[model samples]
Target: MNLSKYLLIGLGVLSLHSCDDFLGNKPKGYTIPEKFEDYSKLLNSSYLMSSSNTVLAYLTDDLYRTSRGEIMNENAEGKLIEYTEFNFSGCDDHERNLYTFKHGQVLTAGNSDPLWNNAYENIYVYNAVANNILNVPDATKEQREAKYAEALVGRAFEYLNLVNIFGNHYDPKTAGTDYGVPILLSEVVGDGASYVRNTVAEVYDQIISDLKTATPLLPEVATNVYHPSQTIGYAFQARMFLYMGDYENALKNANEALKLNDELLDMKPYTTTYSTFGRIVLESNPDETFPEDVDNVENIFMRNLNGAGSGFYTAVVASEDLLETFKRHLAPDGVDMRLRLFFATDEANFTMNPSATPEKFKGYSTYAPYITQNAGFTTPEIYLIAAECEARIGSVSRALQLLDQLRDARIKNNVHYVEETDAPNRTEALRLVIDERRREFAMQGAPRLIDLKRLNREDWFRKDIVHSADGETWTLPANDLRYIMPIPQTVLDFNPDMPQYDR
Candidate 1:
């Protein structure tokens, strides 16, 4: 076996002919092994392919550190500038000022652009891996099942993200009438051709179908707490159902994920010193061993990172809005350890431009080093989902109990606790739950859009003015049409069968 070929096969592009050529270059640079029995190699490739752009995504995306002149200025100068000027406006301000981001641009096909190209290219890789696994005949029943499960989960994850941004949420009752991202599971390649888009309902149906089949087949084996599991699949189902307004199934599936992994990282025993608390949350070391020490108990699913290289993840500092909210809720006496663990503010202030006044960023970073991909399936989220679902079902007491349980984990043996009375009854409880979720998961980018959808605040957020650390307010007007990204124009060009999303 050639180590070079093995590494390249998993990481680099050997064939660039077209996406249709999944098995690029005849498996070049290595002698074929007597038996294609290396399931581990295939697994490694799956993980790598999923994580290939982990760092890039964080560096450039709005969910992380602002790519504007202040935070990332020293590192990614020009790229950050373009991102700040274009993507930032597109994402944060609803594409009002973007000169190039026309609704027609996204609706049309055969547009040779980077954004669409990259999305489809990544989908191509997932398709290639799935296709290869399907063709591997020597795989045992167990191996085949595992491979298929991974493929199903991977494709589902990709499609869900794409549809949410490119299309709209699934409304099964009216799915056929809605437009959705193109449903492409195969690795086909061609130039510009006519195509049309599917409805959001069709997209959700496919996602549910894939996950339903995959969850049962996934093994009970747990390699790392961060990686996907049967429970994670259930969590995704709960989340999807919640988005679909199916509260009953949402509650059921979220509870199922919690039952599988409900333990939270207790802050009580380790809160003697502020520095110690800081270590628990912010410090990342190569080998500061403490015997696991109950650190990641609440992590249901995580992405794994092995090195500090290009493809690995990075920390995205928090926005000022999130930081200020935490500060406002901080106990005047300093009893709230979560505030300390989650954020840090430097006394030194700097101005981006000379004419502008200096101000502190009050930036926040992750307390713990988790895998990238800018998202995780955590116990806290499960608890939050449970609270939301329960509240919807008139179980306010049960819902608040779940919320308090998570809140209790963050506060040390205190002088204080979240008063159950303050949490509100059923109707108001729904709003409180949404507020708690926004505060707790700030900048981690979990289901804020869903809350917006539920409250009919989608139009509101898309139109409201959001400010940064420097107090620059970015505004998105009502139903500006950029709330949903355009389907990559190229996708419409090549696939004549695909439908275009309306502007």
Candidate 2:
């Protein structure tokens, strides 16, 4: 494999650089961190952006191009093609880059953009901690074990997301041959070390192995949501199992997570106002003086989105399909309270600078899934997982009971079971639970897109789904390789030994 410029920049684990220097500037008199405290600090740095990434949101059905016409917020920096992802009737050659292994602007090799960079970079950090922290002479065994467990859990989480984001969904039959991302558990030691990609199954095994081994070593709950805790570990395991289509294990781990933290944010209190625009206007100066109580409850292990370019996912208009879906769940008084709680509407008093054309921005709203999608597991997500698993295991009644627990909080006047056509049989119950998941986790961008990929393996949607916008449409067939992003050509070029998926 040819050496990559990105590798020289991002993969230098042995000779470290300061936070400000990406060009390998060795700060004056710097030394490798040898204290347990130093490695603990390293663990903290990786969790900074573990909470939410909006770039992944573009791949889901919850996003749509406006019907009036496609229009870029004059000042939007990420480019209009970034938003045209899900609904791209008029996407031209330039805008079609997202359909390949490389999701963002192909840089001059060393400066690959954020979406794929964030996860892998954190893995490197965790690997550094896990590989060297054990040698800290000043650390006690308990302290060493605890920090080791955290690094293991963190590495597992990063690898899990990396494989799903860069590799194909796990197909048991083909996983042995399917390409997952590189399994870089240890720090780089040799010169010109060409990294080889592991199979999807190998990657999943490592993730599960790390999580299970770390569970007993981790604290029952972290002092705060910013770091790993037993609950977060269990929650992540539940997520992994669900994605792997292991419903029994998914339900078991979700139940374990619930035991640790089962609180859900009630959408009722926050329903007093409705806006499609969200709390802040797009392209406006960000509102930073914000922090609320709701962020603590179900978000079991809170984290932040560390990537600099991680913003714009919430700046666009809500999909018309999403808007209409919310309308169908209206209460007896004809209101779906979630609409007000989850969206910042154009009808709201929020201001849009330079103002968008009315036809282009009418009914515009931004997605507000939680107080914000900062990071961590939510109580509601676990319940939905349990409910879906229940239906998958042929317990429709139990599933509806669990589904009601969520709907009662989101819909006013006790609008029960998501909608009137809720699920009658186990198949429909599972479908309803999945439907509710799309509604519940929209703008979240993680579970929804992952759900689409994993479910397609079972041929969940019999027919292809069409995404229509601005008088043009694109069809996405079930289990298509497009569902899984290709390993970036830059990555492939860097490591010729790495395997490529079908795409």
Candidate 3:
């Protein structure tokens, strides 16, 4: 297959004017797909498998921004030149706006948010397959149904991210009335067509409906992680149900997904001593040791962080709070494979710049130069989901057992890893599970922000977030309206009548 041809097809469908302009635009240079093979090729396109809303990581507490003045030095010419310190110097205005929770300021009318645009663009690909695959000539019933199921699951994954990022946290009381993202199911959009936002409840309902309809039609395991399988379908259901506070279904689906694939990557083998650092470090290069996102045993479904030009995945370092979490969760032997493998604190090895100062190494550097940060479903996430839901609806011991299983895999030289058994109540058990989630998934995706939004519903779990940069501090109070991100000004400009969030 000519991958470039499909790339052009995907790019041709994108329009800079607006959501409608992009969705309505047809492929100009390629032949319109008319057969099952062509549609299958569309589904198989690498463009649809990768890319996710990576900026969502900025809104979380996992990262801290460095001020320009902190990293700049005066040269012989008396001009200030910025030095790279773990790439934090590359943090841009949009990232700063998100980091500081500057509402209505992250984007301007002419500027487009990659999170919003990439999601909708991928949705167009999925919709194209879902809406027309059955009608394609020269395909068997099973093949058509299977391809259609894959598209539905793919589309649901995109909508799940869109609704969570743009809509408010799900509330049974207000979800039906709260505005969610616009739902576009048709493959082709009419000229000048406009779409009204769907309610949060309606959006969730559609997601659940699609997953339910697609699960049985999908294979037990996908040919690869890029394609959605029955396992991925169940995993997504588990995730969606957890967000909705339906612990029963969350636990049920988590178990179902785990039954299909529960393999976790053991991090101990990836650890080694670097002569330059004089201490343990993860493999100097991940490509040699760590599996690519598509081949990772832990991945149930693969969607990589769209880190190109976005520093969130590669440039951003761990915040003090996140570093503290790693320290707090270290095994009795003072070994946490996650911290050692995913982060670097040795200034010389971390930054690879001799000029880097000790002050610059206050926060650990993210060692993700080659390892792709997956924002999609993974086996360990399933374990965490099962643990959390079990803590809420089942025995606390059962929850700890599940949590211990995952920790044992990640921690080095662990005998049993049953440290959480002392919890006297379900509340303590749930707290442990939540902390484990932060440690395991820190700086990866939108999980932390989503956790904060949902857990704020409970008074016990509710807490404020404080971020400091350039001698100024901003606090986002629990349940603050700013938890919901504002729609990009470009999006609103395109559809003047579209309802916008007040945040």
Candidate 4:
């Protein structure tokens, strides 16, 4: 039941596979999980896999500069550097050294940064669990199958993220030609072998295949939000389908997830409080620390970041544009519950050592476990996707209804539902939906960037996205190759044939 027990057992399982943790330590002998329950515990351990995606926010448009009195500390500056130029596609063309990195070179910790390394490591761990759990001697057939299903779901989610981040955006025309990430299905046992990149289509097929296989095996409910359930699997499918531009399947999966659990957190209660961030963790009580209190009706599956210290949650100060946009749409009063509750009035203030009273509007960081920040895949996301789907199929009224459902919950006093009249036609309705989507998922980071990548392919959603800080501006045009990150140089060095995405 304890995490420590699972940690040792997890490490023991990992040792058997000759896997390396983030800490570069010599391999040691340990026992494999003989019981299915032990493998279940291993799955629960944060150390066993990558907990949350902290780095995706950096690649997003949600971040902006905050002018402050004190000089930024080294850590803050480092983050700013990486935030500006880590995309690797346009760094060479950019002004001002384009952040601390050279063009075409990715930020690295051993091989790549934590996001890349942790993700692959997570894949390795999931592979270990899936390949071994059902064979455990102490479990019944049904229980073993259920645990095995969990592994597949876990593996599927990571691969879904991996392919999207490293591979080019899903294009029927080019996915076959586009390079995807290195697919690591099982633990690497031999002296390290070279890996050629999989095509984007192949990787997508694998992700879909895993999700399809795993969904049927999952229970209706999970032990916790961290664990995947049938509903979570459906949610994952909805997201994948949405990404693939398959509006019909996206709608189907989203509705299925809603049938399982549909709840929306009222934003009214949080009007005067902060949401979550981890920049300054100085607090008298552990409970009062980062991630104040964000458990709400909307969250479908809530796995967050598992790293420490001013983690990805605190990376970006909320941009003024997002705040202004929220104010403009939420009400004429220009004071939304989202703005009041989550963002600080003096957001631009940057102190070297922030005060202990951090509950004060800590920007868009959700009040999550200080150890982790929730990368949301909440029910509202489904609502948004459904709205988008409806808008796509010429259901303007239906799309607005969906937006109102979410808007009514977020806007204070329940008066500000987005109306169909605001966008009378399907094209206009889709535009409204796109705007709402950006506002809804502003601080979360992944969706806006993802939306940009996919939506930009169309002439309608094609607007230049500008990311700026300290007088430097990086303007991304529609469907830029920079959207697709370069595969690591180490990956290229190992397999020379594994072509990098366009620089």
Candidate 5:
């Protein structure tokens, strides 16, 4: 039979009650899924496995937009033709608006936000499996339980991303009233479906509940990285607690995840001395140097940025601040394995117009036939969460030890790697953990922007982010309402009663 047709029909049926018009169209085929295998196919679909929220990267401080003078082209005569009127290079209007924190209409009224759309679309698939898997005719009890568990975990993952982007940071005092994205647990969308926003606390409560319920049902390790396991369940719990500022639970869950799989990918093997650049550079082909998500031992769960090859991973340059973080943490021999493996100067790998000076730009390296930048749970992330929690409530020495352990793997040859002898006070240790988090997760996903939101809760961590273009500057002050992204205009237009965050 035709599997693709059935897949489309299954998804189309699931989307019948979709809140937005994007998924309203009925498919041409009318086949309804009846076999256990049909529901299994829906869960294992590539659309569910590979979906991502890449647009959130534009709202972070990790990227830099090149100035007008830097965006140049050359004629046949080899003379440079600069676009004096253009403000930034290699970025479109939407990216420019997000990068500069424009006050109004970052996304046009009729347009959809991929971050919002991809998330809810994937949610529908998860809800389908979660709501109906047990009743499927031929599945064994164990098999049905496992699929249901996976769906719950997947739905929790999407809700976590949504709430973090669209809602206020989880302030225990205010979260009860703070608006979060709508919570839809069932696949049954009807014409009268309610699309009102849930409170931040309510949404987080649902995430925690889903994870707790799924933990026992999950296997110790998943069959593949795209599927959730007991380890990922714990890892996601740790992430949820970290965002909520619950240190004890975060550390407990983080350690639980690490106990299962704490391996970090050693980067030394991926580097080589290049005579052309007179320094160590990453192996230009990432397919050889970097393992695919399924094969990567570091990943507990894997969700890639959509169109990773052509989107944020390759198109934009690293901000000067982010590059400086790498520079400051360089080993005595001026080598950082992460810097070599993940970032490259324009001279090393030019991605802009030829006439632009190659020496002036540095972007996240995308030397590959395909790119898979994981935005999900990983061992290092858990280690960092554990370390940060230790710094906050447990032990400074333990925090330093964890940081040093991760650093030992990333720093070249362990040249300047020293054990934790002179431990800083708790405040300084926490600062170090926060800094290391930035270095590790720069431009990977929405971590930096989310970090800004959560960290701003403390007086010491509160700081303004400034962005400049075309001789104009925008400063997003700590705890600014802009940190909470407004509801997508299309979402608002469709659900008129839906409240939007004030910018």
Candidate 6:
């Protein structure tokens, strides 16, 4: 009963369909195996499919916060950029940064950039493995079905992230009219490389259809944290429905994901010294080391981007804006120490990177290459998503329950609970929930954008956001085209048949 033997047989089964003749030449000093040798490489690629290294993962944060402003610096020179034209609001206060882009001043394309290219590249590899599994020879019926389900679920998750950033939200009545990304189901090369965009509806339809078909086929869990199973599928389904405004389904799936997995890590177990972000980092809880514990009361699916060298972990400080907001909202008696624990305060004699001149804060370009603590989505986020869906469905109590589920874990000593009186009524409660989400998820980045979009507050989002430093205000205005970034121009150039995104 050696499982190794069975694993090898399984790998053998996986290889027959994955070997691509197109990879004819091995790298220098590398020998081309006669038969497909590393089936696990395909599995590994899916893990890397959406890491911090990929443009798809990191750029989402950059576009949303666009400004380089530090809310903590009262005398910080050069406020974050604000485009004069609402569509270009994030370009810069001067408007000089506007013209270089293709549409809405969003970055168009660059010969040297690989962010967009990497996303597409990931999609291709996933699709290849999926297709190979589907057509694999001599594979067991159950094994093949499981592999197919994994591939479909994995690919669908990739596309879900893709559409959120690259295409407009699905407008049920007009998705067909909106532009989405090109649907590259199979691998292509040479003259056939170019592809046209798929209609937004078509792109989502494919994702929904694929998930629908693959959901039941997936397992309850997988040995590798990277692979998809029933929980990931449900999580994605919940996320998709939330994006679609299908509140009922969103609520259902969100709860479903919670049921399949509900293990929240309680930070209260730690002493006050290690309670803040700074303390937590320097003196981390043993629990923090194994972040992917599915039973981890806070995370659903986390991309493994751990270290300085590839295949390692890198610690990141909370962004300054987020840091200030946390400090501003600091409970008078001080309850939430996560801010202090999560952010680095070695700025005593700190000088901004010379390149970040005028911006005040160092942009990613000038900052050292390390993973931000806020980079990947985490488990507490699921509770937030569940809370949002509950609020949207007018279930204030349900939403409050979810919030409590999250807050009870973080409300510092003696104050085992902080009764949220702010949630006096349903509407106020909903808004409070959104506000709490902003604070809880703070620098993490997903909930804020989703909250703004869900509430249709894109216009007043920034202006309404309080700045602790100066009462300086900023606004993103409603229906501002900038809210939806232009689909990468390279996408348009490659797929001329696809219609351009409406400005």
Residue 379 lDDT, candidate 1, scale 0-100: 78
Identify the superior model by lDDT, candidate 3 or candidate 4.
3
Q: What's the CA RMSD for each of the models?
A: 8.6, 6.5, 5.7, 7.5, 5.7, 9.5
Better of 2 and 5 by lDDT: 5
TM-score, cand. 4 vs. native: 0.79
Q: lDDT: which is higher, 3 or 6?
A: 3
User: Please, what is the TM-score per model?
Assistant: 0.68, 0.80, 0.86, 0.79, 0.86, 0.69
Best by lDDT: 3
Ranking by TM-score: 3, 5, 2, 4, 6, 1
lDDT values for all models: 0.50, 0.63, 0.73, 0.61, 0.71, 0.50
**Model 3 per-residue lDDT tens digits across residues 291-387:** 6677679988888777633244346667778877776646568577887766655333434454444333433455443466678899999999999
TM-score of 6: 0.69
**Deviating ranges (above 4 Å) for candidate 4:** 1-32, 48-52, 66-102, 108-111, 273-295, 306-315, 347-372, 416-420
Q: Clash pairs of candidate 5?
A: 17-189
lDDT of 6 by residue, 1-503 (tens): 00111111001112212234333553311222221223335555533435433222122222222233332232446455432111223333212222222234255334212334545555555565566665555556666677778767766766775666556767788788777777777532333344566777888899998899888888777654566667877788887887888978877887888888776766555432322222232134543432223434455565533222211111223334444454433356756545433332432211223233232233221112222342234556667778877766657777877877776666553222233564555566556566666666543333454455446633324332221112323434444444454555445554555565565
Any runs in candidate 5 off by more than 4 Å, and if so which? 1-32, 71-90, 272-287, 349-370, 415-423
Alpha-carbon deviation at 194 in model 5, angstroms:
3.4
Which stretches of model 3 miss by more than 4 angstroms?
A: 1-31, 68-89, 272-288, 308-310, 348-369, 415-421
